[model samples]
Target: MEQASEMGEIGREARHEGGKDEEFRVQPKWRKFLAHVGPGALVAIGFLDPSNLETDMQAGADYKYQLLWVILVGMVFALLIQTLAANLGVKTGKHLAELCREEYPRFVNICLWIIAELAVISDDIPEVLGTAFAFNILLKIPVWAGVILTVFSTLLLLGVQRFGARKLEFIIAAFMFTMAACFFGELSYLRPSAGEVVKGMFVPRLQGKGAAANAIALFGAIITPYNLFLHSALVLSRKTPRSVKSIRAACRYFLIECSLAFVVAFLINVAVVVVAGSICNAGNLSPDDANTCSDLTLQSTPLLLRNVLGRSSSVVYAVALLASGQSTTISCTFAGQVIMQGFLDMRMKNWVRNLITRVIAIAPSLIVSVVSGPSGAGKLIIFSSMVLSFELPFALIPLLKFCNSSKKVGPLKESIYTVVIAWMLSFALIVVNTYFLVWTYVDWLVHNHLPKYANALVSIVVFALMAAYLVFVVYLTFRRDAVATYVPVSERAQAQAEDGTGAQAVAAAAAADHPAPFRKDLADASM
Candidate 1:
């Protein structure tokens, strides 16, 4: 009777403390949700980056609403993969890069690090060139001068990180919305046929000479390699409550937030395509505008939009492009910092890291801008897209492998349904990307004006490298992970049952660390 009274007294105390906590600590679902918002927004920037904008414009101008389906499908795949990345980080308390370093051998880690660095550099090129193009349009500066200006401009914007990640995310989200407003405003004016846009989104068709190529480029641009790294690392910034329910809630909130971000990106991309299509397909198009549509580039988009936006069209387009470029550049820089720290376990100052990446990205852009002009810069964006296509498998395969491994995520390992769907989709994407890579290489080999011997030599060297690439990919896929970072709850419970003293010790330790309510809950759970 005395023991029962003591237990009842303890229960009453917990209930009283819980009542007080509810008055002060109960938060609306939205309030709790706001904490997990930044990472998804940051990851979404990659989808709206300049390279994506370029692809969207070309799809509309070239194929005229026939490819909106690609963006929809691509975004779905992106959301799935991105959610897995967030879950991995939240459950393991380690980002993808750190996990990769721990999971792979030293030589493999070094190689992966180099590939990741190259991927970042390639991704940054389009952003650099796009910002330069925006500058040339707005300030009447030469593309080379604009390229130089991006160095300083991006660094200044990145200074917001000194305040906090949330500040930077807010700033970038604002810029993304600004870009959306500009495109949607244009979309409102152009008003492409609703039926046609709807049909394009639902029906999958590739009907032209370059339509298949464009579709591949669109997919490659959306599912970026560094983004997987960025998303995983970004979630680590948020401190989730250390409990299964809290962790699962955090992952769900992130998935929702990420879905919303992708929707905005999807709408903006659709707007870009429709705006380009509506203008290009208009019966009233002039001969020069017709020519521009035939070969639409970012530099010519302002001219194309002049029909609606008129006089200040260039200014509006420049502002939108600048926002896209700057926001993406900032995110890429952040991803670089994360990648460096994770792969090599090295941490450099933000400015120093940004400077190194910016310099490497700039050298090629500056040279191309000076020697061959805007056209050269455009070609550089294409090159970067191809590089990303090749790098995607490396980052993506490992993410899948790690997430499916019990040792990595423990009790949070993704379900069999998710695993099956993810791998199938991943396989399809890999096949598409592989086709694009080989096609591009073969097309280059076929078209190059070289002697037979030179062509033969080039083919041998390129094909040899391709063979090595395949071997590396297969190796990463088949290699089993031996490290166990997270212990499953089931195993812990079994351990506790096997040793009552250990269980008591663990419960006592957890109680000491947790609050009264949590302690009571934990005690009940142990019982």
Candidate 2:
């Protein structure tokens, strides 16, 4: 009777503490939504990075409205893949990179890590160059000087993150809002045909000379690989409950937040394309304006807008570009940290990691900016996007394989319908990227003036690399899940089992030999 009374007192104490916690928590719809807002916004910034801007501008200026459908399709694929990534982190208490470490052999793990790191650098190049472009336009600084400045600026932003992820997220969200306003305002001012925009979004077409190539660029820009790793890791920052019901609720909330973020990103992309298309297709362009449209690079994009929206509009463009570049650079740095820590089991200070990545990314931008100038830097962005395209399958195939396996994710494994659709999307991306590679190579081979022997040697090496890439992808797709039979134990149960005497302790010791789900608090606190 005494023991029962003590238990009742303990239970009442718990209820009282919970009640106090509830009182302090955010109430109603908007406050709760804001709490779940950070990770999705970070992921969404990848979609609006400078790489996307250059490609979107090119698409609009060159093909008018023929490739909007690719953006729509790519974003839908992004939503599906990002949702899986978030769920993986939430359920396993491990990010994608950590999971890869545990699931693959050391050698394979190293290869995956190298590939992921390359993807991070590939994603960073455009951001670094884009920020330099912004500084050049806004401050009248040289692009090379701007490149040097971006390294320090990104370091400063990483310092801001020491305060809290939420603070940095708020700043990024503000940048996104600023970009949206600038592009949408431009879209409203120079009203493109609503019907044509709608048709471009729904009706699929790739008829123009470079239309197919731009369509591939659009896919690369929207559906990035490191974004999957970054999203999975970012979800660990939120304090989610461990109960199945609570987990489901958190997943739903994340999905809703991600959907909203993607919607905003999609609208921003559409606005960019529309603004470029409307200005270039106006039929009343001056010679200089027409020439600007003919070579519609990022440097000339703002000038094109100035011709239509006045010189003041250039400031708006520069500010928006600056915001895009800075926000995405912050995200890329965070992703680099996550990838390095998760893959190698080595952790470093954020500033140190950011500095290393920034330096590596800046070298190429600085050289290209100084040597080849702004035009070369713009081409570098396009080339970086293509590199991302080539690297996508390496990251994606592993993600899909793990997410579908029962052992790795247990009951959290994706549904058959989801798995089927995801693989189909993966297949489509692979096909498109492969086609782009082959077509570009074949066209080069046909047009180049190189000697026959030299061309043959080059072709042989290119084909060999392609063959190796395909073989690696196939291996990732079919490799067995290393932890396919592992089961997770709750912390409370694990503690109790370990504390018990004799046989219980023996069983718990044996269970400990197997891989265990990471501690939720530890994972949440680390980020």
By lDDT, who's the top model here?
A: 1
Listed in order, each prediction's TM-score against the native is 0.86, 0.86
The lDDT values for all models are 0.78, 0.77
Q: In model 1, which range of ten residues has the least summed lDDT?
A: 518-527
Model 2: residue 58 alpha-carbon error in angstroms: 0.7
Over the stretch 1-527, how does candidate 1's per-residue lDDT look in tens digits? 99888766655554443343333225678976886677787677677888887888888988999999998998888899999998887888778999999989999999999999998998899899899999999889899999999889888876765567555556556766765676787787776789999999999999978788888778778888888988887776665544465567778889999999888878888888888888888899889889978877678778656656679878877877888887787777778877888899897876888889999999999999999887777767866776787788889889999999988887678988887888898788767766766887889887889999999998899889888888888899899998877754334433432333343333333332222212211111000
True-structure RMSD for candidate 2: 6.3
Regions of candidate 2 where Cα sits further than 4 Å from its true position: 1-34, 160-172, 304-309, 485-527
TM-score of 2: 0.86
TM for candidate 1 is 0.86
Q: Residues 151-270, candidate 2, lDDT per residue (tens digit)?
A: 878877767766785666566667657766767777777878889999999999999787877887788788778888888888877665333444565678889999998998898898
Candidate 1 wrong stretches, greater than 4 Å: 1-26, 159-172, 489-507, 511-527
Question: How close is each model in CA RMSD to the real structure?
Answer: 7.5, 6.3
Model 1, position 400, has a per-residue lDDT of: 92
